[model samples]
Target: MSSNVGTSDSASIYRRSRRQPLAITSAVIGTTLEWFDYSVYAAVAAWIATEFFPSENSHVSLLSALAVFGVGFFFRPLGALFFGHMGDRKGRKHALAATIILMGASSLLIAVAPNYTSVGLLAPVLLVVARCAQGFSAGGEFAGGAAFLIEGAPEKRRGTYGAIHYMAIIFGNLLGAAIVASLIAVLSGDQMKLWGWRIPFLIGACAALVGLFLRARSTDTPIMQQAIMAGEIPDSPISETFRDMWKLVLRGVGLVCGFTIVTYAYVNMQSYIPAVTGLSAGTAQWLYSLSLAVQIPLIGFFGFLSDKVGRKPLMLAGAVLLTVCPIPVFALVATGSTPLVLLALIIVSVSIAVYAGPFTAAITELMPRRTRYTALSVSYGLAAALFGGTAGYVVTWLRFYTASPNAPAIYAAIAAALTLITVISTPETVHRDISK
Candidate 1:
């Protein structure tokens, strides 16, 4: 009997080992779909306003569309609260699957949305509603997905696996960039602004369907299964998470502020720089995409290094560099030289990868198993809303307020300062077991 029991246990372990790669793949794919949907908004921001918010006053139309963009960021914290609780109480897989479904629906609606010419003010209103849905889904998706990846990975290999989470983001950006590049190549400038822009969002909606298919097969983590069997998981994980893991939540906010600034500088800033700094929009987009392509592999290298050294040293280095480099980086872009712009973007992109690489596992391991999702979701969601989501607006306002083109430097400096303060307070989670 003992021999038979040992054989069964061995088989089970072997089966689980085989599933790890698939789980990671699903996590990456799901995250890619979410970001593909989210990032497309920024990638096509200029064209999107022309389509949805067409009006006599170009500035009002653009601001309205961008405000809709910001609306998505604001609703994410609510999604985080709702789905984070569900992940802790129900299961991570279920929460992720549901969020992706909602994300797909929202993307589809944006794809088919009527223009302001056709529907009047209601057009922008509907756009906000769809974006909010996407935001809420996104709010919950990453924290749940990160928690799932951490729980699924082996303790010693957590950072490597966690790196795979950011790998998905790189893939998503690459795919979005590729789509934009392809569109730019084939379509006439007028065609692109009018209708070609809709193709990417349509593609995003379809990609979500593919992600859902992948996520359907993912198995629950052992930690979650054990909690279910023991009946130790809280019935109201949000309340319990708030009570027990608020410190981790604050740490998450600080760390995510760093990530958001990097994203804004590297990703969203490209869209606005053309109008504000007199750079060509196409030139700026090309630089942004090229920098991301270079940064993807660097993200993997930094993540791997974090596992060897620690998350704090790498993150702190990146934060300090961001503070120092923002002025030089933006000043170079303001020169309107393609080579200079590319150089500036690549410098900023590489620096951002340090935090992006290890943050998945680092954030997940901060809280106990029962409150992990809730704590992480609140921290990440709020930070993204306050810092990441508003980055474009803040920089634009700064420029408008000071009438100085180098306003992005001030934004980057603020983010770096916040991150520096938080780095001191956060615990090292690289060597810890998150699934427990």
Candidate 2:
């Protein structure tokens, strides 16, 4: 968040803006770009080790790369504080624009970064700087983007709009997986090690430019506009977040923890742990993308359904499924039977859709509009930093010591079971008026 201390004119455009489609576009494109940054970076972690962290041996280099990757997660909470404050005080529009631009710039830097051989230690340093920027930008993107989209929606349609953000995440993941799979199929190992990895980052950079255009042209959400006119913006959102909204922040963190751990840790089964599925790499990636595609319409449908039935039931059902389903899903995946593996992925995606549909609206609605952006960002950032950031490492560490392939699934279940308790205690927010 900028401390330049200038008044923002972000609310000015909302009155003239009747085009909600543009607001939706701005949200989807910007979010897709932010998530695509993570997807591609995770896919290329090994190659990144060779390019920027040529230390000790291949194993050590890969670990170093992974460490750098995890380093980005630590910066997320910082970004949340910075951009959340910006969104609350400067207006959501300014925060949205700044985040997209920073993300785009970071992607561009990574795309053209020098290899260790060419620039010595400076190469890895540059990589870290870029990754940190990415993490910081992501920290605020989701909370701000969700608040922005939901604020612009019709009362009956907030869930549907919120679901678009989740759809964009899936789309971003699929896009990254597809592109990386395509390049790996076309390029030789040496080619991929040398220059092939840059292609995806370049494409991500280009996508961010599109996000900037959409956000720049769009207005702030109407709810945010009203908050501005009513003089409800906070002077110190961080203080308020810890003081008055502490309970809501805890609820927000619990709701987000299991959801992100599962989404980030396991939807990536084929990419990171392909042997678990016992399928050819290309075949697994394609089927994985296809199976997850099932979540798209289901998310939209469930979102609309939540608007009718209320958010708690759907979230409770999803949490129940997430707690119990991962073990069985991975059990099916381990069989090496292609059909069973595909079915398993679909089952999990549906569970995700069930949770994903209403979680954003339910969580955001927990806070008053004045502190919604900051509080949401802080809680979510903390969850990502704590659970999401450590998910892969914890799963891998457990699998190594326990000699059980079910480690990741078990980890997901335990975290989700925790979330189930939180959701059960939370009130239904569908009928609440958020503009206050």
Candidate 3:
């Protein structure tokens, strides 16, 4: 069976499709809700620990709660497998719609879940179940959302459309931060521990609700729709993707690692810099926000540039910049001045923006449409499970074990070098015929 049926009419029509805007909106909203869910949970993890993971040692309880959250990582690949198959066999719309509702319901479940004081071990058990469901939903979200958005885009405009995926995530996280901060400001410490934390979950559920409504009204991408109408949807996309596209998966994993490490490491500066350096938490946060402010506006420009100059040059440059960043990093930290740190943070943000701007569009274009959803999801889910969540972790450990703040810089460099190697070997896919 041929993987894709090339069709200019479908692509052209879909570019002009009335549903294109709606499709993009649905995917973006869904993606935002997914990340918002993550940010909210992390923000309230301590309360969750106290409420559901009571322990003799407070540290142990917190670790246990975090461990339960980490369990979501294990479920992500499974969700990818399940949704990938559904997407290829049924349709992207089906899988996305299902995931959105399930994700929302999962958040609601957590919001209303009983605490350890009320339910013994069942409280933690319920929390685990809800979090696992959330993980499963998120597993499919990135790939599904990207494919959905990019496939609807005009061939030349896909890069900018893809950048919106990353933008939505940033907004979700910022929204979470704002929401949590407001909750903290309005509530007393006791009230926060007792109930305020659940408010974010409720808000996340509401975001999911809006996304679901949008998705319910949306159509599958033009490429996927063309495949379905032509009887081209894969009957067994799971095994087929693994058998035929494993090399692509390997390359995708490398890209995921590099992208996640560089981008997340910078994003998490506020999380760890205070512990490692004399930077105050408030100062770190403002510096982080300033960086985000700088990067957010430029992502679209870099993505648009990718459309003009192709993805390879921009990505390769960004990768190389990250690889040799240790000297600059050391120089900036040596001064320990707030102004210098802010300047350094903005530079890091631009590097990440240059690299990530075209990343999703490039990766989405690489996969064959017959099993695009499955292949993309499996590769991404696997890489993210392994290394995507490790950026901050690796930094923390490297600093601890080596007792040098500069030690953590190698983690990002190694990941970037791996990505650079992969990018060097891959052909420029900016002009690749994704319809095939």
Question: Which has the greatest TM-score?
Answer: 1
Per-residue alpha-carbon lDDT of candidate 2 for residues 1-436, written as tens digits (9 for 90 to 100): 3433232334434543547778788888878887777777767776898899887666567557766766777898999999999999988889988998999999999999999999899999999999889889989999998898888777887888888888888888778777877888898989988999889999988888888888889888777777788887889988988899899989899998898888776544654546344576666767777876788789888888889999999999999988898899878887878788888888888999999998878887787888888998998989988888777656545654577888878889999898999999999999889887
Which parts of model 2 are misplaced by more than 4 Å?
1-18, 53-61, 275-280
Q: For residues 1-436, write the lDDT of model 3, one tens digit per residue.
A: 2334447666757666766678788989988888777766655666787899878876566556656766776688999999999988988899999999999999999999999999899999999999889989888999999999888888999899999887887777667656776777678889988999899999888888888889998887778888989998777999998899999988888777777766656655654556557875446656666677777767788888899999889888877776776447645754668888877787777877787788889999989888889999998888767765555556655665676667777767777788888888878989888888
Give the C-alpha lDDT of model 3: 0.79
| lDDT: worst 10-residue window of model 2 | 3-12
Clashes of 3: 0
- TM-score per candidate, in order? 0.95, 0.91, 0.87
Candidate 1 achieves a global lDDT of: 0.80
lDDT of 2 at 345: 84
Candidate lDDT scores, in order, read: 0.80, 0.82, 0.79
Candidate 3 off by > 4 Å: 1-17, 49-65, 117-120, 266-270, 273-287, 325-344, 397-402
Candidate 1 matches the true fold with a TM-score of 0.95
